[model samples]
Target: MKVLLLVAALVVVGGGIGLVLVMKSAAGPEKQATKVETGDCVQLTGAGKEADAVKAACDNPQTPYVVSVKGTVKGDCPEGFYSYSVATPLRGEGVGLCLGINAQVGLCFDDIKTKTPPPLVNCSGARLKISEVFDKASYVNSPCKEGTEEVISYTAYGATQKFKSATICFVKP
Candidate 1:
């Protein structure tokens, strides 16, 4: 009987320990903070500036994410309220390059009646695939007008790696 009791106790303890280990492993990688994904863009904060950040954000590099760009586009406002594509900047590493996305810019009218803004797409948390290249970069631009506002966003993985860092900026018309 004593031997039977000992065996039961051992089995229970082992089961508990096994359960704990399984839970921990299922949690996957640890992220400092939650990443935010909008249909057009993925933003990650607190990740390292390069490869480390890319890996941490993606948690999986095999998935490709489609990025959307929005904001006040430059040039005369469209016949009605509409958004257009700007230009995509080069993807490489160059210290002290130009500021702001090189693509077209968008402008939001403070007082205008139009279709309600569309739902923001969640494109965050995608992995940036990195080759063995040393430095890479990409650029995007917002349009400009005399009295317009420019806000832009780009969604892509490995941005922090190729560009060494990714930044979102507003250009005042």
Candidate 2:
């Protein structure tokens, strides 16, 4: 009986340890705060020139800006806030010009081809909403949001043949 009790206790302890490991794995890695870099992708928290901006994964569907140019901006970006340059300057020595990405979300392909793309806007009150965002391989399998009316996808071509490509999904309400 004593031997049986010892075996049972060992089994229980082993099971507990296994459970802890599984839970830790499921929680995922913690994200660390990092500085924005040139060619990095970012998302703005609010409207206006002084809005807070956060670095994001380039493929992140929520990301609206793609760092196009980074340097000590001379006077003002010729195009102004809506231009390639961000409305406000970034921290550190130089400013980063973030070109708007996925701005063609709501409009049809023909519309996109004819007209110039618009500036990035916050998610709320946007005519075009991102229902699901994924890479080229996973886009077809990704699910759409409940009220999504239309689905559209955009692909960003890289400069080099070896560059990895990304795809974004947008929905019109």
lDDT of 1 by residue, 71-143 (tens): 3224332222223222222322211111112221121123222322222122242121111111122244333
RMSD after CA superposition, every candidate: 16.9, 16.1
Model 2 scores a C-alpha lDDT of 0.45
Candidate 1 residues lying further than 4 Å off, grouped into runs, are 34-169
All candidates: TM-score = 0.25, 0.34
- Colliding pairs, model 2: none
Top lDDT: which candidate number? 2
Clashes of 1: 38
